[model samples]
Target: MNDPQFNPETDLNFDPDGVPTEPAPAPEPTPPLPEAPHPVATGRVNTGRFEPVRQLYQRICSEVSKVYVGQEELVLSTLVALFSGGHVLIESVPGLGKTLFVRTLGKTLGTKFGRIQFTADLMPSDITGAPIFNMKTQEFTFRPGPVFTQILLADEINRSPAKTHAALLEIMQERRVTVERTTHQLEPPFLVMATQNPIESEGTYNLPEAQLDRFMFKVMVEYPTAMEEVRVLKEHSGQVAVEQRLEDEVATVTGPEQIMKAIQLCSQVLVADELFDYINNIVRQTRSWPQFHIGASPRAGIALVQGARTLAAFNGRDYAIPDDVGEIVLPALRHRVVLTAEAEVEGHQVDEALRNMIRTVEVPRM
Candidate 1:
């Protein structure tokens, strides 16, 4: 007990200077800074921003009515293709407003549009452009072709040979044209509304399967109804001045910026896991089906998701639903799937097969 003179209590109180010292106080926590605005939020329409898009759609319908008398469904599908950032193939007879539809869409959207009239002698370089040698620099400067525009009207695409069609397919898939080893990216919101005369197969090279797969939709334009025919006559039967007056009355509804914004908003629409599984099952069934030689490619699946999102946005929905997938299934997969000879001989149409598949496949519940 006497040796415990070097006691624990005394030792605990002593410091290096023989004095007690307290512990340093803890530092105060720093608050976090506010976050910046999201990149996706820049041009997108929240809840209240969709009225302008609906109004724009209405104005487009009205303007297109001036030139195109009937075929409201055709007009809507064309707009769907445009809004989805996809290419369209119009299969119809001549004098069915195919050219008019493309031109009117270009005007309505206020985007740079160009028409490439396909012919037997048309070359790939003509549509994709060629490099020219500059006299001053002695360098071959790359020049862009008509496919560089926001809206490209490939009139009678099948009329051209397979080699010429390949050039367009390349552009549609890659969105970048290569000239003299230099690659140039096409502007955003690019859409190709192509038309082919179904009545004329003579001397026309049929589009290869690879080329057809690039298009998102193969729309068939049929004859107008009797009442619609009368409307067409009344609208266009007058003198050229009257038609010009009617055309002049049509105004621009939306611009390229608005279209880009809409496309951005469309991408923001959510697709759940169940819907993705549904898409996977549909695409897999195409491969395993005995009725077809070729199946839908990976690109087809991408188109399905993108097209559904676009339809969802058009319907003013913030999230994608099963109905959106059903709505776009035909257009997204029709051109991608190649039917066998037996299926064709059996008089089975692609649309019918697609509809049957859609009906058989169960939609997942939310």
Candidate 2:
């Protein structure tokens, strides 16, 4: 080998001269971390297949807010039930916009709206039409009742007797009416929103367990905040009536077909195997929880799953998250479970007990 060159300016490739330092190996590149799905409200998650659902939700809320000043959760619960193809039983004082909300919902949905003011005298035949003998035809003709509408408001439902209440059980569950052994099927996207007063017990009958079970959610309406009440006053102080305002301000966003399509999307929302366990765990936990005497039936679990799916879609997700289930569990199981006399005596509300029980259930990462 030749003598090593040591000149300052000499190329380093020669002997003794740095042989390029073996081309100093580059440090191994770090692999990228997998991306996580963020909270849906943050606008980080891709809307993907459920974008329409989210958009529809926003539009309806926007239009509804113009007239109905507050009670956001009430609106959301109704929407959840609506998308899940289930009924809602609301408990609120009068003049809190329950009727106004339902009317606005029916307007935005572009569906027919009907209201039945339940009284002690209200009969089954009054809600479900009975066959009337026609003199012209010389035969009986079946006349459909208010129940035939796509969106029905059963106002003050508890005022009606059990027999009248029984009429709704079949209509709610089957979306049809059977009169004279002839079945008349209701159109698609039928929604029944029944409201009862918690303050009135003298004239109100307690809802049967079976009837209560039919409702996917039992929403309790709270008084609006000061700002909300001010807005309500400002909006309603005008000479225009609520119906006039709803007609002038609220715009129709969709029809029954679109609503049915959204319902289908909610039905297709992805649920992990673990999520099934999580929901089962929650529902089953309610059965044995020390606070509850009567737990939710299997229908409650079904309602939870369906409600969660609809909520997930509302958040612009095609797949449900545990948080979605958490938000939905309250309304889904609150009415289904019964607190024990001890717990009730302890001044415990069924809602509070349900939330506490849910915290004990393990959440799935999915």
Candidate 3:
């Protein structure tokens, strides 16, 4: 996949099945953006591919902001997860526009959106679908569930029981659901945007740590600031319903093919070896940290690396820097790490602990 964005301005060509038919021409070299920590170690490669990827990233950010008045980090992490082949778990109070944010992204990306409201009574069959009998044929047939869609909104995922949660584990990691020994593969560019209210637990089930680990990032969405809240109210007030507003404001700017190609391109973004050691040392310290009881797993280390690579691509660089790793470390490992009871009693937060821990790890000059 030529650089993931498939730039609208450029006229590079590709086969119908997404194979590059001709090599994209390298554009004239432009001076690199000024560096804060250090210069990018390697000169840019595949500039043709990286341009479109950057363009698409900017366009999505521009379009999604039209209707969703949430944090830039929420949008950033969501796109990072989308292009990195990862899932996101969003924690926020109800009515803070969590569903609206996901729906706006689905519309802007031009991908099919499936929403499953997870309730205590929701069964496993309801999520992954179940076998149905065809009366005329007198045979059973499989019907796929909401998990089969391109962008799935798992609303209030913590509301469902563990049995229901087990259904998602296989699909999240393997990207397929098995029923009666038959596996159904999901189409490409599939993402699960699961939401939960952190303050409510009366009738909710806590997500198992393993299930939490499956998510690439655990984003915490906060209430819009006073001015931002005013802007949302001003821009959204209308006699037309919310769906109609979405139709008019948020246009389909990209699709699944482009997204998958971007994912392929993200895998190509370079990570320096020192950065690899940088990532490893951070994860290892989490285990021995005085504040954390349970440290991150190896998967957390992988997430950090992948997220850094993808974020680097979004920034139009073919090579990743230490800033890229710093940007992803907190959200990437927040849910994966657990705080000790003493630390929790001392009013320590996971994010704070991670920030302090990473400071102890040496940052690479590159």
In model 1, the Cα lDDT at residue 273 comes to 83
TM-score of each: 0.80, 0.87, 0.91
How would you encode candidate 1's per-residue C-alpha lDDT over 1-366 as one tens digit per residue? 012122122222323332223321222333321221222444333342332333445556777776767886677677777777788888888887676667677776777888999999999999998998899999988888888898888988888998898888768988999877788899878988888887878988989988887888777888998998888888777776633643586556667766766565566666778878988888888886777678898878877888777766555444566777776677778877778899999999888887776677777765
Which model is ahead, 2 or 3, in terms of lDDT? 3
How far off is residue 175 in model 3, in Å?
0.9
Which ten-residue region of model 2 has the weakest summed lDDT?
Answer: 1-10
The best-first sequence of candidates by TM-score reads 3, 2, 1
Residue 13 error for model 1, in Å? Answer: 69
Backbone collisions counted per model? 0, 0, 4
Residue 84 alpha-carbon offset, candidate 1, angstroms: 1.9
How good is model 2 by TM-score? 0.87
lDDT string, candidate 2, 225-302, tens digits: 999999988888888877788788888777777677668767877776777899999999999999999998999889
User: Tens-digit lDDT track for model 3 on 136-236?
Assistant: 99999998888899888899999999999999999999999999999999988889989998898799999999899999999998888998999988987
Cα displacement (Å) at residue 167, model 3 = 0.4
lDDT for residue 72 in candidate 3, whole number 0-100 = 89
**Model 1 spans > 4 angstroms off:** 1-52, 134-139, 241-247
